[model samples]
Target: ALVLEMKSLLGALGSSWALAFLCSTRWDWLRHSVLCTGRWHQVRRSVISFRRSWPGKIIMKGSSREWSGTMGQHNMLRFRAGQVDPMSRRLGNLLNMLMLGGQWDRRYYSCTVVVPENVMKDAQRVGRWVSRDDINTMGLLRHNWGESALADRYYPGLYKKLEEYHGVDFHESVMCWHIATDLILAKEEKEKEDFAADKRVQTVRALSNYMMFLLVNRPYMLPGLPQNWLYKQTCNNLDKICNDYDLVGSLGDSLWTVLKKLLGLHHHRVLESSGLEKKLADLIMKLPKEHASSFSETPRLLYARSVAVIILESGVVDKVRLLLDLWMDFLAYAANRCIRESHAQKLSTGGELVTIVWLILEHLRYLKEDPNQQHGHV
Candidate 1:
């Protein structure tokens, strides 16, 4: 194996050197002006020695034509510029990158698998059923019961609102849903149910925060032109609301303190979460009777608050079920619409949940469309 590897390495080096020599010979001015000098021959020998090394082998593995073409161009430029060492230096740097690029640790990312408290408490058969049937845990399927249920019985106006949010602008939709989800989660804290332990509730919260995080930090990963103005405007208005109501720690708190509260620090969660939601709820209540014109400037945020109120009117179980449906749909929607390059870029850093979801959806779609899949037994 080692002998074969060595033979291949020598073959590649010999080919590259031969290509380089041919190109150099064709360029008469480069040969006469640069190569004939005694010092130039020494430099050429040094470059060839460097090329014989393993890193050089990797560099030589690239397109010989491109490498030679680039080398000739750089040679002319360096000759004109009266800088001979920089071409070799630049080549060394390229070789270094090729050698070192794969050595760095890549952070791997994965979505958390949520097991509902009931699933944990129940028998394995029941757990298996939930795993197979639950959209929140599994993801949207071709014949999802939740999808059918929502299509059949959900409010037409709410469905229209969702369509509006999506069709008009995706970033706006994400912000709207994120705000509503946050408010709803805060509201649920007051209920008898243990929200922190509920799998669906946690899933809703995770995806909501994640979408917002992408909007703020990784806008390129999301679809559409990022609505920077909308995000900034909404944030400023929320700050004003917090300031007016003193919903943060105190009236005299520093900017950082207020920001910490806004971000929901572990210590400030109870205080800030409830206070902010109450203020937002009150603000939603105070909007003018004419809903269309009242909050025209910051409409999505207010509209989201209103949506949260409507969702809240349902029974706790129904409300949670409704929210779970909405968030899962949102997750799938974002995944489907996101560009391929964004997903590819995330691979070098850490992978994203949305990219994974996108892959799953694409695979499922392929399976659904396959001619052979229809006849397969379970």
Candidate 2:
């Protein structure tokens, strides 16, 4: 028994070092910024909207002039349960459907809370895929946008459960957009952290893990994706290639050229020299209609981010800070909860948390191996 305990403890520690060693490449790009855990330097502003002076961002010294904001602007990290709008309140009827309806989901599965349109819809629209915030209807105005691909992790059982009980389509693409938008915000955090400090590494790790989740466990995030797309493999390959080429920061188009050549995608294009844009979604996965189709509209990356802009635009320090705390909480949540076999069947085919992307591998390792507990495999 003592040997077992020691092995368990060592395994836990090993996972942490393994994750750090594995991501040492990405860590190099995390940019040096002071850790602002207990530091709260408040700068009061008369500006009401971010339309002029960017709401709350302060330019940090070093790390390429990156922008980071105050996280202590709120009195609470968890939101009031009744804070949602009427439409969002109605969505609370379905299991895992109504996000932020309870304490656990609000604190963890928070990206899907669907903060109402009345308060958050008109901030910005960067793409056609960027629609209103509606997780229930999936931010879809019409059903003909694209045929949905139900991923094994989120659909079938979820769909059947909803259908058998509530008689709703669950709006697969739109729901996926929630997860997609979820990622967009994470990516945005990553971009900002590139220049600022605070929790930069944590944000990057979360974004990396979340991207891996979308690519591996949830193909529904990429609707109409071909079965033979090989995007997941390509993404892993890019991670390796980026490491090999020392291509940190914004993976420039040159890496895409190498990636296209590596994947034989360069051979199929007969038309011309089209430059590929460096997008996180594109960098990590083979997005359908990547250049032309707005990533098949399954994600509409940063749609949720636009909603985030509204909160910032509201100029409520508490709202912005609340969101910041929630994101940090999510990072913690993924590290602790995402490694179970019930959540991911195989380390090879599962999310980065199961393999490489988890922020705190020791906690996840403990969760995965605790047989006395009921989760992981169930």
Candidate 3:
């Protein structure tokens, strides 16, 4: 039956004249398979001939089992497949479906070979597979489920699958926000009673897991995804979390710490080692007026101190001065917002101004070092 199917597929290829010519050049096996399968001796002889000739011819030009094996190896598919236990074939198939970017559709058939408990165990194994740098399976899940109807409809199921498998509840604020956003966008019910009950548990868990992962990894670049696209996704998640969760509470403190790490603003070591000074400057430049104005005076002063360091390192004092001039204009806008709202009392407006003066003093010291330095002669 398999041979007949192969022959039918090959026959369809004969309509293309070039394929016909190629097949004609390789017809010896076809002749043998048809002519010799009848008698016992002929069948043995044909089997030997078939093994030698069939695979080479059938694979077509410039392709080989070895080549496919190499591709599978590169994709981690071969390694994963080889690691599958004989008893866990169903779990393996589920994993393979996920690896291949298959979505969970109601119409898609799934055989119930194992109980939900075992299935959940298998799901945890799948989650572990995603932590490896080479596997990137979770990234695939996020790609498919982040903005899809499947994410909306099967979110609870998906989260349950993850939790049952991984034994972690992963209920971070950012994650909760992600679920909430998806639910809202999907026009899902937002019943307060349901929110406090088991109905919202899975969504909450999935978000929590995601947030925990991010907190530990502090990832600057997400593999198999563009940086800007990942940044946008993260920003949306962060915005939702902030809007829904209180920032002054314990949960808010945890979130603030994570955000500080994400923004590369936690420790001085991170600031220096992570190449984040300029990134922070860019972020500051891009912030909405309200957000930009929320920084306490000391933090703004520290930002100015960093700006001075950047200016000295840049070796373009004049250009740095011009950039600072423009930055002050932005600060003025933020200050105006604070003043109008009577929130200036809680922030340090004077410290920022003083920091600017200190920056000017440092620039003069840098300028006085050498006339030759200005012209890049040394």
Candidate 4:
């Protein structure tokens, strides 16, 4: 074994000198050949060593490629399959954001998983993220009953609004989806070199995409909310808000971005400069009074408040992790709301964001089974 190993090592040497050295009998030729042979091995080893240590050589190719601004369905499928996990920071961190949502700490805020206190009391741990008692959780009740019983308790105004409008408050999810798509556009257009590494950017990107997936494809599980593509409309408004300021190619991947987004003052000068406000009023005026009245009063801040609330407790001045976690948990709730078949149908067409999230949740042992799942199961 040792003899074979030695021979193999010597064979790896790229040298005619080593061959000559072994067979030569002349003293000077032998010495010169030996010297050249040893140097050959050293040079060969050094080149091999350098290749191993070269960071550029090892950088994942996917990260180097232009990010898919659309977060296309196929991309979602690959990301969920784990083939892209090691190579794609954008998808991986976004996945982590969903998985670690309430548990992650930004020093100011932490993501919290909520169960109705009554359910938690009776709950016995089952799956890692879920338990036996939580079968009748928020979304299922909303699905079966066509309205979340707990909605009015926790979000009365939103609940009342949904009651009247007959939908849920996922405007934020759709909002995030728009922000993420723009970030992808920003990344591709060379808007920011650090866009992929920026967690705050990734958080909005992931949350928004996942939420929009719910709003678009899984409306029934969203308690069949009847918002008129409010999510899609807000995406247009968000893009306009930035374009009004020529910030489309310059969306900052930072902690307080939500504040900049939601605050009317940030877009104040731009709105005045562009006369977008008056134009918006003109458009709103054309709608029927009831529809116009309920349509967003401040298109600029439509989903900004939703983003703001997700990140509010995160010590916005300090860190983005807490905010990321909150959005993750928020999206996770959306991911968990469906029966298996709804996921399959949407997944077949373009892929659903919630399916990936739910798989990861179940894989990571964080899922709590929806108690009402039996009734909704196909």
The CA lDDT of each predicted structure is 0.48, 0.29, 0.28, 0.36
Leading candidate by TM-score: 1
- State which candidate, 1 or 2, has the greater TM-score: 1
TM-score for every candidate vs. truth? Answer: 0.50, 0.25, 0.19, 0.34
lDDT of 4 by residue, 1-378 (tens): 785565345444533444465546468765565555676557555544543464322322122212212221111111122221233324335646788421211111111111223222111211322322433534231232212322344334443432322223554434443342332323232434653465454444444343444444345544335464454355345334333433312222244633332231122111011123222322322334344333365342323333333323323342233333334445455556556676665553334445555554444343335654323221
Instruction: Give candidate 4's error at residue 121 in angstroms.
Output: 29
Give a tens-digit lDDT track for model 3, residues 20-103: 454465687764554345333444344335434743243332212111110000101111222222323343357567873122
Return model 4's CA RMSD, one decimal: 19.2
Better of 1 and 2 by lDDT: 1
Off by over 4 Å in 3: 1-190, 199-204, 211-222, 226-378
Candidates arranged by TM-score, highest first: 1, 4, 2, 3
- lDDT per residue (tens digit) for residues 1-378 in model 2: 785565344343333343445445355433122112211111111111221253112221111111121111100011111222233223333433645333332322222111223111111111112122211232222322221211124223322322222212222322333233333343444456442233432332233233333433343432334332333232233334334334334222354543343232332211111122123333433323433233333222323233334433433333223333333333332323342442343232222222222323232233443453232121
The list of candidate 2 runs beyond 4 A from truth reads: 1-306, 316-324, 331-351, 354-378
The lDDT of model 1 is 0.48
Poorest lDDT segment (10 consecutive residues) of candidate 2: 70-79
- Backbone clashes, each candidate: 0, 3, 6, 15
Q: Best candidate per lDDT, number?
A: 1
